[model samples]
Target: MKRTALSAAILLATSPALADTPNTDDAQTLETVQVTASRIAQTVDETLASVTIIDREEIERLQPQQFTDLLEGRAGIETSQNSAFGKTSSVYTRGTSSDHTLLLIDGVRMGSATTGGASWQFLPPEEIERVEIVRGPRTSIYGSDAIGGVVQVFTREGRKGPPKVDAFVGGGSFNTWETGVGVAGGTENTNYSLSVSHFETDGINVQDGVGDEDRDGYDNTSLATKVSHRLDNGIEVFGSILYSEGESEFDSTEGDDYTDYVHAAIRAGLRLRLTDRWDTELSVSHSRDENDRYTDGSFASQYDTKRDSVDWLNEIFLTDHLLLTAGLDAREDRIDVDDPGFLGAEEYAETSRYNVGGFGILQADLGRHLLEGSLRYDDNEQFGSKTTGQMAWGIQVAEAWRLRASYGTAFKAPTFNELYHPDIGFFRGNPDLDPEESETFELGARYSVEPGYLDVSIFETRVDNLIAGFAPPENVEEARIRGLEIEGGYERGQWLSRASLTLLDAEDRETGNELPRRSPVTARFDLDRQFQRFSAGGSVIAKSRSYNDRNNDIRLSGYGLVNLRASYQIAPEWQLQASVKNVFDKDYETALGYNQPGRAAFVKLRYQQR
Candidate 1:
């Protein structure tokens, strides 16, 4: 089964290898997607929201070594990587908090019950098939932890036959080394695939007293497998599992405790067709994470946790233009913490969340007009029940002109870490904390001309009950976030170019002060050209200076980075790739006090069966 699935995935990619675009004109049409937005698949042309899809070929062209690098500096988004091993990777979208952006792996939520954020470093970039990003309120269908937006990652699945294999290995600057292998194949009605990869690096020391350049180091390993079988009854049964282990060394004040971590997970799903237009899906998954940090020998800290979830989905198609979706999801989490620093006592904490949700969508297309509406209800154990809705419209004024607008509302619940924390000898729990909510509006226009495609959008979002840490007198405060986002991009025939710039103004409605650690000005640019067997491109990322602490006690300087990549086809079944990251060797920091690496270069050779 695994062999067959691997074959299918490879065939899927290789089928369109000769062209970047799909064969069907309908597939090429830029219609709105309802599934990621509201549970049921709806055309984007009729919904009120913003979403972006980056296909696998795009990732292959960009050659982003780390998954987070693929999204950093995107429009209305920010990335915080404070450690060498990327242990504490967090993303902030649309001026929202780090934990606000929800992440999904193969359509399953990857949020942690303890931190309420996804572990960005656990997945391997080589295994990714595509990425879908939705900006603004989407909690109506996805439930909690989706205040700012949602990021869904899809992995490659098997497609063809005759047992196929591919492998690549490379070494670069900073003593970085990486290797990966994948295989897939199968007989009729069955397919399977397996992939494994490892990466290691001796990083730079951004801090002067934290040792020299080679002292900071990191190691990571990942394994994934997928198997699928088609039953005689027209049902498809499939299972996939992902496992990863990683550790990193960082700069510490005491020179004693450097950050380190380990994690593993497994997931399985079943899908079946009730009729030509109806489908059902059932899935279950489990995950465990273990972390340990030691500096001066006597164990500085440790964290252990596990989580499990089960979900069911049903889709009913009333017609081609309208659809209905209903589902239920339940999850449980456990955590154990042993720290000598906080109150000098060991702590064991556990929590559970049960959610029942139902969703409906209405979609229609007439002449040049497209319309869509969505509604959802979620009942939760901790925050009770809430209802969310969205409406959108789009029109094609001409062959080259298209316009779209949408409005939506979203809600988010607090994480276990925010609710319960042991501070010195004091215990803090916010049972009174209210769920955060937001409403967003957006308008966009697209123009397709000869040799290029151009698109621009403007958006605004307003939020209430914004979560933040407060001081003695106030204890805690609910704030508000209101901001504007603007972005534009153009892709020409051989010369592809894109640029995005966001100017956000966020503040605490209570104190009327600017929000802490927020980057008001952020921008990115990419330019590339391909001709014959050689392809090359480069990117630039920049962020404005931002505040440090809650009181705005300090200000951190902003920095810029440059990256370049070039690839060449060595033969019909072989290719060569090279990349230069942090081209100018700039010393920059995403978080206030941590250190970031300098320039590095990498090269690799790949082989594939035709």
Candidate 2:
């Protein structure tokens, strides 16, 4: 019944008489511009990659307190939620592992070399102005860690005008409460924004015998600041600092885990028109991250790591139809892990890893055809050297149709934990692990209908030497994965709808066993409508059953979850919003052994002015 309703809505959206004057502020046209698809910003209609952008208004519409929640329902995307407030969530793309994707903040890499992945919990929603997601390999533009794709989060700091403050507070089920406040303002030459938020909850019960305290809960606090200064001669300097801390209890153990993390970055750039018909820019940035994890009581385990890096990028326009870009990046990481109970006495292990890479990309256009190619070379102190490449092309087949195709190669180095962790525990890192590599191919087309738009893509990726750890005795090894994604959306005036479906088939060629944690099928649908002073929407996510552990010890039964939201504009500057998540109180889990929230509601009020 719901599927029928969704289909009917799509059909009605493409019918005649649905026209409404395009409001530039709330509507999406065919010529919308996006920057993450390509290193150089270009109109989305003219770009050659699969990309998605969530602006601040839409982010507010969903009322997601954290930025990570906003990314879960998109195409070629997957999110794992453990408990309500305590667990750190992870994302996957195109059936790829979490570590295969890269996370960036205003072009600064936030991934940790020690973990070979990102701890995304530190990012709070209030400070984000927008999020750009580019799907597929991005070796040409982003270099390493761009295997699956790149997610760039831009903060809200460069607003125009006098000082202003934005704040929100809300409460929901399971004793959940949230509060956030931020301030931003700018002059002709300077701008800055600072924000802080807190989230806490008394989680629900997953098992009958498990006490509410056993299911436990989590508390998270985050603070972030972004600032920029403009100088004479088209030069600018910018800096940002982010800090977050989380404390939460475990389900089985009567203990808690605490994590403290920080990220800081600064950049300086000079943009100049070198000559007539020629333009160029040079920029340099430095970034660092420090992270520490601690556990309480008898199960105490500790890890600390730090990363420092620098990057230089140069771009030039040689002609109207051609552009060139070159860049070099380097990073060094130091990690220290302590085993309080090891080999009669406590032992400490330390490791250092360094990575350096150079990249180049070329873009050219000839009439209705556009071509792009990118290449990168990286040298790792522990894994030796590897080179990755990508090529893409776009063609205007008809006045209303555009076609695009791309192919690329990506590689991932071994993580510090994978190389040095103890061999007798639940997880034993393989010291002789090799780098993993894969080749991905994608084809897509987009058509502009009278009142809306339609887009479809088919993709396949083959991975080799996939790094994964198995049970005791059997350590980490490699595997392969292949998948397909279908996504479409339509919006006509007050009504908007979107859907994404993914099918994956992956296996371990070595053992001929099905890959663990690979969900066979997943899909999501979101529908929304706006009428004069009020708007309402709802979404449904369906995931297929899959295993929870690498050794296939646990299994999770897939299910469908629903969410609904509504908002009313009382005045031009004042509004009220409310939302209900997990409407049916479904008992489900995205991660094995961990419980999730059920039947929650949140109400909020907001004020804004230009």
Candidate 3:
């Protein structure tokens, strides 16, 4: 039956076109480019997967206060936070677990292997140039932890023009303050960019029915720098670094708990144009995540994790319509935990692990047909070996329409904490746990007009050997997820509009119950108008109710939110921007017992030159 369904899907994806309708009138259009979908640069229209790009212009227009805020309204993604500002957060893509997504910074992985997720809260938005989101399994190109998809963030880079300097200062409710400054420039042979930012907020009481009434607060300081130089011999050297430090106060039954944390990454690489048909890149990077917790001015616990990685990639152009890419990746993870007397019977310590992988990709374009295939093999110190592969096909059905289908397999290794942590009062780690695996199939279509485009996709994913924490870690769970996503945008004259809708049906196979925190419906819409140096916009976000536990007994209510924004150029080099979020002040909760922010307003003054 499965084979028959797969064959039918492929046949429908390659069916002959009904008609070829072409637009004869001249109209403005935007070209979208993406890199995460194929591990190589290609336009979104040419790629076979669902992808979304958020550029610097849109980032500035949205004025998101945090990383979670920036990605909240996108299709196939949902986020939950413990509080308003800097707090614990999780992102679920396509109804998958939070750890199923892979995160990259300038092609370098950034996260904690022990925790199995990245520290999205500490990433400074002021230092970002763009973000690319690829939805669906991508284990063939990337190794593991890509069961859901991948998110790649590019930092600010120099532009070919006169040097530019920019600055911004802002303050708003909750006694919040934000400030940042940056400089970027480039010459024919050299380019550099540097930026620093700081943010602080008094915050609100984050815990309900707590003993303490004091407000929780957070403060962060970050720095980002990048430099590149190209030799006359067609060889280029580039490097970038990011550093962030912060302190956050939160609610804990142990005592007055607070944490001091630091997240940093350094990457350097070299690119060589060996021949007209061949190119190579070699790179190395190191990232660290460190945190120290204190209770009432006394040291409590500490966690420090570091990762070192090396990559060697080569791309070969076989023919005008064919391309081949191969790469090698090696990574080492080291973790140190200090909790001597905190637990009743367990004393955390230090451990290390390593993994090596090799991957290859083949892409071909034949007239109106596009085909891509990828394979990867990984050998881990803990787990023996694993192999994964994917195949995708796309066909142009009409001048303005395309159809695509893909199938892939992915796996996720158990985290260090889940595998090695010692037993402590009703909770323990299982060292015998095996890695979780998943299989995914997707079908999609896209239609483009002169001024706008629309995309829709249907996907199904099945996971096995799923891990769960019930007194002790175990892999006696399974899941089946199916979803549909639709997104589109249009722009004409001074008016622009964008919208997206996602429908998900995620459940556990064993219990035959809904998955925790997986909403069934989510939607968003935005509209804007521009006039001379002034622009105004409004947005709406809505979601369906979801369960908070695996048993599907506890329910969280659904809600809708509206936001308004406006900006004006006060001068050629200066501007004023303002925003009002949750305009109706709706009271709601994304996570049970954690309150979402109410109506809030903020304004900022900016200066820039180019």
Q: Rank the candidates by lDDT, best first.
A: 3, 2, 1
lDDT tens readout by residue for model 1, 249-307: 76565454455666555667777777766677777877766677776545777766677
Clash counts per candidate, in order, are 35, 0, 0
Residue-level lDDT of model 2, residues 173-209, one tens digit each, is 7677888888888787677888887877766553334
TM-score of model number 2: 0.87
Can you write out model 3's per-residue Cα lDDT over 527-602, one digit (the tens) per residue? 8889899999988999899999999999989999998999999999999999999999999888898867789888
TM-score of each: 0.87, 0.87, 0.94
Instruction: Quote the lDDT for 546 in model 2.
Output: 81
TM-score of candidate 3 versus the correct structure, residues matched by position? 0.94
* Lowest-sum lDDT 10-residue window in model 2: 12-21
Candidate closest to the true structure, highest TM-score: 3
Better of 1 and 3 by TM-score: 3
Show model 2 residue runs off by greater than 4 Å: 1-28, 205-215, 255-299, 341-350, 422-431, 470-478, 549-554
Cα RMSD of all models vs. native, in order, equals 5.1, 7.6, 6.9
lDDT of 3 at 188: 78
The model with the greatest lDDT is 3
Q: Which stretches of candidate 3 lie over 4 Å from their true place?
A: 1-30, 253-255, 341-350
Judge candidate 2 at residue 160 and give its lDDT. 52
